[model samples]
Target: MNYNTTEAFAQELDQKDPLKEFRNEFLFPKNQDGKPQLYLCGNSLGLQPQQTANYIQKELQDWANYGVNGHTEAEHAWMPYHEFLSESMAKIVGAKPHEVIVMNTLTVNLHLMMVSFYEPKGKRNKIIIEADAFPSDKYAVESQLKFHNIDPAEGLLLWKPRPGEYTCRTEDLEQLLETHKDEVALVMIGSTNYYTGQAFNLKAITKLGHKHGAKVGFDLAHGAGNIQPDLHNTNADFAVWCTYKYLNSGPGSLGGCFVHERHANSPKLKRFVGWWGHDKSTRFNMRKDFKPMPGAEGWQLSNPPILSMAAIRASLDVFERAGFDNLRQKSKQLTGYLAYLVEELNNPNIRIITPSHPDERGCQLSFQIKGANKSVFDALSKANVVADWREPDVIRIAPTPLYNSYTDVYTFIQRLKQVLA
Candidate 1:
């Protein structure tokens, strides 16, 4: 496909967009003059779908009418509310319905998954992770290490990139696994790195980890609903993610977890148990012995939050309607257009840190604005371009194909050029 730096071309693309109607389905942030700002922040907090209120209102109504009986009598039936969302949620992450569950927040779910999978024995106590893993993940792994009385400085192995490169290479990971073949107990990676937006080959990572005799898991916080991590196909021991980001659920929405079917029925597997995870047949009887439910639902510890799930349902309804294939196709074109525009500037200082290969990244393209500071980010924000700024000279922009337009990409680049000038 031929590409050009023309506003008319951008508009033409928008006109031809099959998913154009989705733009109106979301409420965009407005500038002071009340126009929709060029929103590219979906990688952080996705825009609210207009139908979210209706979903919430229905639950609110059920609570008002049913009171204490709402658990069994609500329109969504609170007793099994989370189950209603399982099929669609599982589909989003590319896992079987039995393998995925909507539950606690991301970090909390990570800890839960680790409780069962991170079995350290003798010399195999060390954990391997990507160097630039999200801080929360690092903290969780470090805490897990400390919990087991292992010193993080000694027990945590970082799979770093080649000097000065922003993304980690899989060959480096393989080399690291080979070097520490006997020492590793777990290999926990952020499938799509939060900082660099690098999407790893999940199946490859899992295969490598298994070959080295280690449990492999992924923090799919960035990969879920962005790139298809294919959790089941990867045969990852476990995976976790938050819904608030690319899933377009409300702010700080509940997270999701996946445990491969192989471990789903392991009664011997240890976990932090709760009544919700007990056998539903005798849950209310409250017996002394904890009869664990089967599959991913076995990891859950509490009743579902219908309010949050309602919001998730609303966003997922739109996702189900639009379909990920269409969204991804639009996403590549959108991000590619932004990458092209950035290159058009011809400024040696403005270099894209994201991989040029389509499969290596999702929607985000991190720009290393050499010598420029956060002030450039501030100016961009003030110009109504909502992007993210990381410390030490990087401006992160994402063109979410769901609600963002080709025109948004063109206008953003024009504004960025003005800011650069």
Candidate 2:
């Protein structure tokens, strides 16, 4: 598709967008001038869905009317509330209902997954991760090494990109594994890199890890709701992601976990046990031994936070209506347009670090502006373009297909050109 620089061309595309109606469903932040700010920060935090307040209010009303009885009698039934999100959440990440669980925060779920999947034996005690993985993931892996009494310097292997390159190559990873041999215990990676917006090939990584007799898992903090990792078909041992980003749940909402069906009932897979994960039939009984529930449900440590789950339910409903496949299709086109416009700027100082191919990224385009400072980002903010800026020089803009129009992309580029000029 040829992209035009004209704002009229953008309006034409917006008029034809099938998902255009979704923009109305979100509540955007307004600039001081009283117009909606151009929000291109879905990779950081998605705009609130218009229905989120209603969803939370419903639960609040139920709590007030039913008191403690809301646990069983509310319309959504607090006791089984988390169960309501299973199907739609599963679809978003490309997993089966049973394999997905809405529980805990991103790092908490990472720790939980590591508890079960990061077992190290004999000489196979090292872990492999992306060199520039999200800090939390790196910290979590390092902490895991310490918990197991292994020195992180020796146990944590970094799969770094070549010195001058910006993205880690799969072949380099293969060679790293070959060098490490069977000494590596687990392979954990961010499905979509946060800084560079590079989406890794999950199936290939899983197969490579498994071939080395290691467990493979992904941190989908930037992948969920943006790029489909196909968790089930990727044959990953486990994956974890938060809902607050592209999932559009409120800030710090509950995260999601996906455990492949193969481990659904594996007795040997050790995990931290809790009452919520016990078999439902006897869960209320005080005396029964803990019988773990089948699948990802077995990993829940406690009953979910109703308000947070309510927000998630609200977002998932929107995703359900929009359909993940359709959203993904629009996302590719939407982000592709942003890339095209960025290239049209013809600014040698601005270099896109994100993968050029749409398949290798989500909506985010990370631009490394040579010798740029926060002032450049400040200019964008002053112009009412809400984007993300990492330390050093990268300015990250994400033209989300859900709420962002083609016009938003055009307008942002126009403002960007002014700043550069």
Q: How well is each residue in 92-199 modelled by candidate 1, as lDDT tens digits?
A: 889999899999899999999999999889999999999989999999999999999999999999999898899998899999999987889999999998888888
lDDT of 1 at 183: 89
TM-scores for all candidates: the values are: 0.98, 0.99
Kindly list the per-residue Cα lDDT of model 2 for residues 282-391, writing each as its tens digit: 99996899999999999998988999999999999999999989888999988899899889888888999999998899989999978877787899899899999998
Clashing pairs in 1: none
| Model 1 ranges off by over 4 Å | none
Q: Give the residue spans of candidate 2 off by over 4 A.
A: none
